[model samples]
Target: MTAKIEIYTWSNCPFCIRAKQLLRKKKVKFTEYGIDGDEMVRAIMAERANGRRSVPQIFINDVHIGGCDDIHNLEDQGQLDKLLFAHSGV
Candidate 1:
């Protein structure tokens, strides 16, 4: 089965855009939360991010993958694909 993914972002955040681009390139479908000025949504995102308080926080299969740089780091290490297409083999 495909891994579930989610991302918290802002409307004009470059990091968010880049993160989406990478996921799209990988053909991974993810739910996005654009919390630009919404304090309520930011609060929730912060809680879920373990007090990270940063934009572009991501989650894979309910596991927090952190921000754009973190995901990019995973890709750099040649490991992001493993998480995106996890199945019986993984």
Candidate 2:
């Protein structure tokens, strides 16, 4: 089974665009929640992200993967693929 991928973003946010770009480049399918000026959605994202109120908050198999830089770091460390392909127990 494929891992479930989710990302919270804001329209026009550069970091959000960058994060989505990376996921697209990898041909990964993800559910994106665009929270442009929407406090409720942003609040939910923050909660899932352990109170991190940042754009481009990501999740793989319901596990918080953090923001744009964090995802890129995982890719740079050669660990992104592992998480991408991991099966979701949920």
Candidate 3:
């Protein structure tokens, strides 16, 4: 089974671009929620991100994976791929 990836971002956020680039390089399909100037949507994203109001909040198979730097750190540690491919058959 393929992993379900989601990212919350603003249209012009640099970190958001970088994060999406990394995912594209890895060839992983992802859903993006671009909440630019939308306070209500941002609030929802923050709620999902454990109160983090930062753009580029990510989720892998419904698991919160944090922001761009966090995801890059996971990739550097050789852990992101494992998380990406883990299948619980849910």
Candidate 4:
């Protein structure tokens, strides 16, 4: 039940780097959308993020998980693993 992970980011963003680092540390493969200077992509990401216009927006199994700090907080709370591994088996 490997959950599909996705992230939207701009190049040279530290939060994106940190987010990817966490995924690497967890040994997870994810799809990354680098939206450098692309307003349309950023707009879509913002809409998906509930108006969060920040880089490093993340999703797991289509569930919005937010940026690096949000992810770290979830991990600190011992819940990131659950999100990373959850699958509907569909």
Candidate 5:
């Protein structure tokens, strides 16, 4: 009944690593899609990210939560935990 978290990342991207680190530190399970240099996969991620062709696009319960700084910003504002602990009606 937990929220389903997903992230699109590039293997060597620092932002991606930082984002994943935060998620791991929180001890939450998330699905990570490592796009690397695959443009087709990147295109799919971009579409899900509202045309944002950046690495480390995040989603919580299928809701777009933006990139690394965005997730960190949510955590800073005391909102990330709310999303992480939510029950998805899926």
Candidate 6:
């Protein structure tokens, strides 16, 4: 089974771009929420992100994975792929 990946972002945010790039490099499929100038959507994303109002909030299989740096850190630690391919029991 594949992991369910999601990312909240603004159209022009550099971090968001970088995060997406990393995911693309990994060849992981993801859902992107581009909340550019959409405060309502941003607020929803913030709520989902534990009150973090930052762009590029990421989630894997409904688990919050934080922003770009956080994902990169996970990659550096050799854990991102594990999470990306983990199978959850339904």
Off by over 4 Å in 6: 88-90
Model 6 lDDT at residue 61? 89
Please provide TM-scores, in order, for all candidate models, with all chains considered together.
0.93, 0.93, 0.93, 0.91, 0.93, 0.93
List per-prediction Cα lDDT, in the order shown.
0.91, 0.92, 0.92, 0.90, 0.92, 0.93
lDDT of 4: 0.90
Candidate 5: stretches off by over 4 Å? 88-90
Q: Which tens-of-lDDT digit does each residue in 1-90 have in candidate 6? A: 669999999889999999999999988799999998899999999999999998899999899999999999999999998898777431
Candidate 2's C-alpha runs over 4 A off are: 88-90
**lDDT over C-alpha atoms for residue 31 of model 1:** 94
List clash counts for every candidate, in order: 0, 0, 0, 0, 0, 0
Winner on lDDT (2 vs 4): 2
- The residue pairs that clash in candidate 2, if any, are none
What does each candidate score in C-alpha RMSD?
1.3, 2.7, 2.3, 2.4, 2.5, 2.5
TM-score between candidate 4 and the true structure: 0.91
lDDT of 3 by residue, 1-90 (tens): 658999999999999999999999988889999999999989999999999999899999888999999999999999988887777442
Worst 10 residues of 3 by lDDT: 81-90
lDDT of 4 by residue, 1-90 (tens): 678999998889998999899999988789999999999999999999999999899999898988999999999999988888766332
lDDT of 4 at 34: 92
| lDDT (Cα, tens digit) per residue for candidate 2, span 1-90 | 567999999889999999999999988899999999899999999989999998999999999989999999999999998899766432
